[model samples]
Target: MTQPEPLPSAAATPAPAEPPSRPSLPSLPGLPDLPDSHVDAVELSGPRFQTEPAQVYRELRQRHGPVAPVLLHGGVPAWLVLGYREVLQVTQDAALFSRDSSLWRLWSAIPEDWPLRPLIGEKQESILFTVGEVHRKRADAVNEALFGIDPFALRDRSERIADTLIDGFCERGSSDLIAEYARLLPALVLAYFFGFSDSEADEVTHSINDMMDGAETAVESQAAFYTACRELVAAKREHPGADATSRLISRSPTGSEEEIVQDLMVMFAAAHQPTAEWIGNTLRLMLTDERFALSLSGGRRSVGWAMNEVLWEDTPSQNVAGRWPTRDTVLGGQRLHAGDLLVLGFAAANTDPQVRPDPAVSTQGNSAFLSFGHGEHGCPMTGRESAETIARAGIEALLDRLPDVDLAVPAQDLLWRPSPWMRGLSALPVRFTPGPRTLG
Candidate 1:
């Protein structure tokens, strides 16, 4: 059996080279002047962020045209590659662009020896963390695991859990979607995969959120989260249950208990966190777009398309996959040193106009979007039957039970989680009509 062709290298590829002397951040060419149309000024920080990103995205396209360099949080310099082709180039070329977070050490306050450094190692980093052959091999392994799970069984279990939560909330009339429903739903699914009891799952979910909160104080909180994950893995091994944890522990090449625990922790972090945000964002999008919500409720054939549209429009992950510059390279016309951090802004890339001519359309072909990322380090977990099954099941369950659910509070009244790396509402209060009861 022959191996596949290796992904392109960042250094070897021919392109306009960055001059020997590093140039100052180049001015974005072809940007249009800010529009004179009467429109509400939307701030991109604080409470405004939830509503502002899409508007800013549209405004940037209108004012600066596509491919403008926008100032992100803390005024970090980042090129917003809004052109579809440009964004795809950045996303698809692993050699020219990197996803290693360590490259941005100077920009972040975290210490150099942070434990996360090992988790996202020089090679087998998270699915979104590496490039080249090393990235390809690891990605294949993770994808196999992710997709190997039975989707129907997973969805059946998820539906039961979602129904149970909805039943509990329906009696109470109004519920905080984030704390009561959305948070618990993903955590339960994750726990089930880890072979954890419902109670243990809830605890781990809370702990994960706490650790994320302490990311600025990451060393301590991450240590705590890892400790919990290790304990769970140990228990799963002893019990030998039918969940992902047991499977991974039994099959992992790194059979050491500690190594198994570390792998599980990495998977847990990647799977649960962003999923929670996706659920919350989906709810928020439904609230804001009544027509879209109506489409879902009215049984319009476009629910799948609408879901994709929502995913693209409100990307849950704010950080693009980070990569380390293996050698000197140039991206978006900016020269990067060998060790520079290259962030492929997935959110910015997803909204790029060149690839997605109409941001409103949900059914655009797969190659145009970056919600799941691209290239060797791109999210290999995507297109896995298991994830698709889960998504289909979750969406179906949501449509069946709470089709018309909308935010109980005004859009501005909602609270967003503060982590720039993740975008999920901290609490989404919503009102919905109760679904018919199901007997156990």
Candidate 2:
């Protein structure tokens, strides 16, 4: 992958803070450099990442300051940047800390069957991996396609989909929001946005849910998604419509069908998983936390508050696949050699005591949280708005339909999905009064 150039808008945006000046551990004289070994490296996974990650990040900060040496899947050495300032610095300076993962030093040692490879290794041609002028064009094309979506129409589509999904289980008086609603709504709406027919939308929803679940069917589900994307692009090319797929195909600079397909897959995965998690996490917070109790009665104000709070406290994107140093440098008092992977610890940074002194206070209107990320590589504004629209609309629709809904299981019994990278519920079982169905 080519190295990422600074965003074209860099000149207008304020400069990021300089890298922290704290000195790292001094290399002993006459010792050969160890590229892939760190004596104090902590494992970035296990029960702690799922259940008590905030506490774990806090402990890591105490042990290793802002940037801590950590082991990724398969004991791959990396740095987890946990400070707000450090994360900002790393994300902002894309030139120094490049987005190209090909720079990673341990690829020669990384097994072909490594689980994380599908995410970070494969799909190198996608927009997520592209940089420089090429990346800018692709990013612009994507934003333009998404921006063309009318907000009111998007909201209506979301509402209609939410109603249709709710209709299936509304009479049953109980449903697992994670499996049934939260996971499916975004995929269905996105399918519609990309010009999938009703049947294709259903297929997409099923496949995306399976793919994200990391189940035995994940590989097959991924293949199905790619096949569907190729078919969709082909259909769009032969007969363009007022849809995102058509817009993307028409505007893409390369005009390469494969490039467009890869980008669509990237967009689909990125848009669906996080938006689903956002809805689930926000609903979980509102249902469990007293602060959001009023929102249950269809209070629009508190719905927005609950959603904003989730972005700060339990962002769906907990950590992000990160930047690699172009050259040896010190960051947050830790030595980073060229090719060292640095995971952007968004969840940890949000809770950093320097910026957020009191976690108990409300973050209702604050937009500084790195939940949507920061700098040139941050989640694009159109992407953020579309996700927010989908999430807020989904939550509001559920509340409007089931005003008296309550958690079917005890608050303690509601388990989170055991993944290190995302913060979302495994199941949000809720029961409500069975009422006559109405099309929303």
What tens-digit string does per-residue lDDT give for candidate 2 at 298-353? 55669888888888888999988878898999999987889888899999999998
Lowest-scoring 10 consecutive residues by lDDT in candidate 2?
1-10
Q: lDDT of all the models against the reference?
A: 0.58, 0.84
Per-prediction TM-score, please? 0.74, 0.91
Roughly what TM-score does model 2 have, to 2 decimal places? 0.91
Look at candidate 2 and give me any clashing residue pairs. Answer: none
Clashes in candidate 1: how many?
12
Which segments of model 1 are wrong by more than 4 Å?
1-49, 55-83, 99-134, 213-221, 236-239, 256-258, 295-302, 358-367, 382-388, 402-404, 433-440
**Per-residue lDDT of candidate 1, residues 270-356 (tens digit):** 777667677667766666766566756674344555556656766776645355555776555545456544444567667765666
- Tell me how far the alpha carbon of residue 64 in candidate 2 is from the true structure, in angstroms, after superposition: 0.5
